[model samples]
Target: MFRRHKPSSSEHKRDPAIHAPALPHNDMRSFFSLSQLVLSAGHLKPPPVLRHSKTTYFEVEILDAHSKKQICVVDKIPPSSTLLDVKHKFHKVCPQWSPSRIGLRLERNGSYLRDSVNIKALAASSIITLYFTDMGQQVTWTTVFLTEYTGPLLIYLLFYLRLSSIYDAKESARSLRHPVVHLACFCHCLHYARHLLETLFVHKISEGHTPLKNMIKGCTFYWGFTSWLAYYINHPQYTPPSFGNKQVTISALVFLLCEAGNHFINVALVHQNQSGNKGSFPSPSINPFTWLFLFVSCPNYTYEIGSWMSFTVMTQTLPVGVFALLMAIQMAQWARKKHQLYLKKCTTYRWRKRAMIPFIL
Candidate 1:
């Protein structure tokens, strides 16, 4: 499971090795910055073992910045080794530098690369420092969703809540991210917030922060996205040029259906997941039935698109429209990727489904 690597910095000034073994003091806190520790934690993720081993192994050259020298040459590396792993080996030699502190770069099949990609399991190397700064952000992900338009903001909130409720633990982490999430998303978000702290740290829980207490937070977290939308729509003294109750009602119905669909799909996948069946029968953790169709179908993604689309239809605001477009594109990209992974990994996988879209696409 582990390989021994030679530590030789080809570039840096050669300093005397500390052969003296005093206290193995835990100054890793000193050597590793906060971000570095998190990066290391993330880097600890092991590669998914593939069925076949590729030939034509690549030689990754590790450059030592100190001496401006090309130090060690890593040979016969499996295609499975990530650019990050290469840098990790480099760091072993260049102990004076962490990935965050070095000028690492990757040359993949002799080309400079950008973005997160799996290059057909080929021979390539990166300037460990630069690649990881970009790569780490991909692996450690967190972002808040906000709608530019106010009317359909509720729909966005519902969409976010629907996705997050499945991974409820993330909400508690969000409390550390922002008190606003703790204060006013919606009763649902607050419910999850309470669920999180109680699930993890019960003794230090607070009643005021309970999802029930933060009605405003709950509303904003789910629907109160555009502060001005509600004000303009429900103003007591305001009069509308024309009212379209039928259109509004239909949009609301679509939004509700999407919300329900997302909730059920996640529940279905979670229930059917069998990730622990490594011995006799194979099992997946949240195995879904979306792959049965032709393209790589992700029903959750379908619901997500629908939810946002409903928001756009209801609000008809430029910001909501743009956000919906971005979300749809991103969701399609994700669904395609997952479908591809399933196709590549599973012998029984069927490729008839077209992502979130049905056969027409």
Candidate 2:
């Protein structure tokens, strides 16, 4: 029923085999085309990849203190730590080593580094070589002071109680004890008891440990002197002072006053430490005994010497006098050293002040 028509040139040129083929859904070309289209439209982005870099750490080289031979090299140590922390790390490598036993030195002849020193605060270097020294037997300062004080207190008491065989048979049968002897025993005991108490409760003692040899030497000095004084003072032939009861009363008063003064001074110093008032010179506050600070640099030593002097006067014995004189000499030396330290540490310290005495050395 349709009229016949001639075929157009485009339709005559078109062939089914020559036409471009449509891409399949799973084809690589189809995927690439889809990715390009999404990228051009700014709808998708590539994911980020993480790459790890080599970790960096500080190096610590340890060497024998005496021989200077390499002992061990510790690597990968964190810089934000302390010498004490480093010691623990070293302890892990050498199970036998301990923090207390290890002493680290920056130089061959220099002093050992304190445990509180920070690792990062040290001089900057690629490798830090620390001299390792084994600290021998050590004891705390508190233990040394307690032992030294307690020994003298008990040893002197033994003499006063007549428990030792040093006294004669006739003297042992005496009816009543001498009043001066009784007073002397009380003063001696009180002096050492206060010292023990201060060392334990009041004083802010540093955490430094002392060598056993030094402690032995100190104990020898204290124990030997105590025995000598106790023996002579409690002797049967001991005589009262030539000035009689008046001299005894006056000396006893002086001893008690000085003992009280020393205790007050110690308390004030402890307060000073707690308040963190280090730079300024220490001045007396309500306690008049602390007024000695105005004239003398080491008023505590001055009070100590005065107490011993009063004891010497009360007993009036050659051994007691000798002990007081020797103690004075030693305390004088300590006072001078402390005075120098105060001057160095506190520039505001008065230069007119004497070391131990009020106006004389």
Candidate 3:
């Protein structure tokens, strides 16, 4: 009878406010309120992320080479930018200076930086300093070449036609023109015509430009030489070759051979360059004309000299001989420089190859 008394529903439902242990408002309530505030804020908006950028940028400072004066500062350049890109930016800052006419170097008198060089490679820090030189007025190499070659052709033709102003009209009409005179005209025209054609199609001329002064000087030389040579060759009193048909025939044959060889060598050089072997030492190819490459570093110059020499012998004129000699000296200088460049660039090149000659230059 004194067993357990059954709890009533009202006793089971004791007051939650009195029976439940009170939470510490300083610790639990504060933490709960703080957590609830954080959750509510998070739901409303994401927390701002303080991220650091990893991208690198560059700044370039260009100064005058001689005066050391500041040209301009190009900023915000990417790491992948090249010298060409810097040149473009510099051009924007200074529109008067063209990219081609803008020469940049590390030092005042130092060699210019190539357009292909990377800006990052040249930089010692995020900022790079360059010396700028305003290369004077420039003309395309093609324009220079065309002008140099065309003047001689037209000048030679003018003399050959024997205008009344150039030659005495009565003497020119009475004077019997030698068979060699006509032949010499043919050869001269052929030579210049071939050069014009080669300039247009065959040769791999540089994209670089020449100084306007240099082009003017070159034109003066070529036009002057053509005038001097043509004046004597086509003169009314001009004589035939000394040894008659024999000397003319032999020299003409030599000239023709040399011209053909020069053409073949130039073609081979173009092919080599097109095959991605640019600036490399040229070697002998399947073509017999190109075989001269084995003996001469500049076979084209050799053929050029040979053609002139044969022309001198064909005409047997003092002016032509003098022209040949001067041309030989000039070509020798060019060939020597080209040979030195080949040797410098290609260590494996044959030492026996002369600049222009086969054995002795």
Candidate 4:
């Protein structure tokens, strides 16, 4: 057999398509190596990356307090939101309900949740439940106080002026008004005027509101009692105090002292609250009026009762006495409630301190 002749390297290089088929002239792979193709593809047209972001969202479910049925759901709220923010959201969903008229609680019969509470703190998990109460038509505390104090001032003034419609024409024309009557009018006006001024300028009232019906009832009581008291105190037939000037003088001095003490105590309370020490046990300060705090939990109420009692003694009238008695009863109730709150919240509060009266109450 004849030996096959091997092809030389120069022959293979010179001949085209001798061992393999020829490639297309426009082929890209012809000018690039495998590694170069991969690197260029990566830099020019990279693959897309899939990324997912995680965020925490909260859901608040509102239910009726009485029925325990779902009212609405506030969803997708951020963890940083507060109860006030939730109230706004709820208001948007229920246009008929106002933020002031809506009361929210954790349980059906629980106390209302404060607007300052954070939603994250209230949430046990991603979803939180709240109870809703439809507080009837609301009025601000400022409006209620203004109405209550203003009516007494004006009503007493009307009687004091001896208006033709209110008094007998013959009685008004014949008998001269007593000096005590004038003094009583001055005291009454001063008391209510001070209250009005304090309500407008001094008191640090909360943003809370009261029911309209309650305001109406309060106005009725204050206005009715004022008219009753003024009719007798400013009457032409009215008699002076029983022990004459001596009794009147002593009672007036006591009234003035109590009034001054009450004002100072109120100022101290406002100052303490502004100093960011609210809800803490208030101690005696440089002011002498605050010394009563050592003996009584509510010195303001004590001074208020003292003022009214002195007024009753100065007038020496059954109406004034009745008014003072009723007022004292009410103030005592309020003071007791406040005293209990202080005892519960402040560990340093003295257990021996009374509510309104010291030593005996």
Candidate 5:
């Protein structure tokens, strides 16, 4: 059974912000501080190319209620146009918006109103709201899945990176070598890059573009993505120091168990939210370890630190090992804050409910 990090009752009494719905639990939060701002997966992709695959090229359709003229228009669209283009279109419709403040409305099929919306295929009830009067008078776009529906954009960006690296293959090979060492490095870069883009885009599109103090504001790692990553590091191919098959196999299984538990919990959590039971987005990636954290506090961070430590032992990568150490320091800060919050808020909360570990700390 996974434990959910339960703060004392006294902690809940004092902090209203602590009652937030599930926050996205992306691992990128641990990598770059810049990722907290870019929240979506696709913000970093390049312009779309519309390759002639089975998927059709993007098209826009306009419908109007007799008296209500369609206020939306697309003056000019580059095939490589980006979210910035959609915002620019809004500025033309209503001149008050700055480039920073302007955002376009999605047409419910999860796309910009005028670009590539498969409206006919969408639900009759899906109404894309471009502006929220409750939040503000100025029109702004939704940030749920900008990159999900879009294509060619991701294609362009990925190809660019791969080719860019290819152009420098000779030089890179001299230093990084080939096969597993290189693949591991590649995965590491992708993981960090993915985190940076996802976090930054989320900030820009959904959360008002405000900077986060740091990524792990108050979440636990219930998800064990880090543990799996660690498995490779602990392998002889990566980290010969911890190259026992038992640790590799055991850590791998523990990670899978966390993954399975996460999905099972998600079935209920996702269904509950679908029935209009939540305030914001269901977390980005909730793992099984989350349930574990209720009792353990910060299991995600603890597992991650352990993963990297083992990885360091396996791969003998001093730089990445140091990176993991710094991450632990950050997690320690989060745990300390939670510990104080527990004492202050939860009258019934036991003093022994340590943030990262139980009883020992």
Candidate 6:
């Protein structure tokens, strides 16, 4: 056989599509080089095409919270609609329902949805469902409080005036009126009167209604306590405190100071709330009376407890002391709750801040 002609080295080098010449037989280096070339070309394969599902509008269904009956289906609600906007749209179909009296929830028994939440903010599917509950017979918190406080103020004065036949006439004639007793009556009236004024004007209480049952319970507590305390304080046989005039003077002064401080704190707190600076730690300003906030998270409760303690000292009666003690316990509970709320909302709150008392509690 004729000898095969070999291609020149220049021809192999010049051709772009020329395959490499055959590797030397059983040469491991040449075999490895061929493997590397194959691996380098693998990236040329096209990546799998990615598919996405787009959502434009949402479908919403409303159901009664209690019976789980389907109220209506809302088709094609835009993402920009707020919860309040949805409520208004629901009101159009259901004429019996008012927006203020309607509470909507995400689940059957879940907490009501806030009006501020937007439909787009929720991680909802194409179909969104909301449960509705009827919020019946609403009254403002200020109205409820004013009603409760007003009753006690007038009822206590009835006892103070001795207008009711509750006291014995013969004993009343023999009983000597202590100056401290008159002072206590004046202070009690002043306190409740101030509360009424604050409820009407100074406080920027939120525009929310309290339940009828809660209003009843609050009235019972306040009116009942006023009767109980006023009965003893205004009694004909009531005697001067054991420590006499000196104790009365000092306690009365303390009571006045604490009452003034409490009013100031309430004003400051109302101003703070109105300023829309919630979720921030409260600090003392130019008002020195509010400086108690430096040590206690709830200085209002501190001053409240102080006022009651002073009253207990001035009266020096078992009932007054017991009332003061009970009030302290209740106020401490309120203070602890407020303190916890402050801690949760305010990142910069002082770790050493007490609930009500300074340094001790």
lDDT of each: 0.47, 0.86, 0.90, 0.89, 0.44, 0.85
lDDT of 6 by residue, 261-358 (tens): 89899988887887799988767888889999899988988998898899889988777777788889999899899999999999998989999999
Q: What 10-residue stretch in candidate 3 is worst by lDDT?
A: 11-20
For model 1, the superposed segments whose C-alpha errors exceed 4 Å read: 1-61, 64-68, 71-139, 142-243, 267-296
What are the per-residue Cα lDDT tens digits for candidate 4 across 240-325? 88799888889888888888888888888888899897779778898888899999988999999999899899988888889899
Worst 10 residues of 5 by lDDT: 210-219
Ordering by lDDT:
3, 4, 2, 6, 1, 5
Q: Please give the lDDT score at residue 215 for candidate 3.
A: 96
Number of the candidate with higher lDDT, 3 or 5: 3
Give a tens-digit lDDT track for model 3, residues 1-361: 6989886778768856656788776889789989989988765757799999887899999999888989799999998999999999999999999888999999888998898899889989998999999888989999998999999989999999999999999999999888788888888888888999999999989887778899999999889988998888889999888799999999999999999999999888888889897668877878888899989899999999999999999988888888899899999999999989998988788898899999996
- C-alpha-based local distance difference test score of model 6: 0.85
Candidate 5 accuracy as lDDT: 0.44
Is 5 or 6 the stronger prediction by lDDT? 6
TM-score of 4: 0.82
Cα deviation at 229, candidate 5, in Å, is 13
lDDT of 3 at 260: 92
Candidate 4 stretches greater than 4 Å from native: 1-54
Which 10 consecutive residues of model 1 have the lowest summed lDDT?
137-146
lDDT of 1 by residue, 134-233 (tens): 1221111011111212324344354434344433555434433222221123422432343333334322222111222244344453454443333332
Quote the positional error of residue 135 for candidate 5 in Å.
20
Pairwise lDDT winner, candidates 3 and 6: 3
Candidate 1 RMSD to the real structure: 28.5
lDDT of 2 by residue, 1-361 (tens): 9989976777757855446686676797878988889888985567888888854467889899999999888777777778888888888877677676788999988999998898877747858889998886678898899999999999999898776377776766774567888888999999999999999999989887777778899999999999999987777667778898999999999999999999999998888888897766688987799999999888888899999999999989888888889989999999999888889998778889999998897
Q: Between 4 and 6, whose lDDT is larger? A: 4
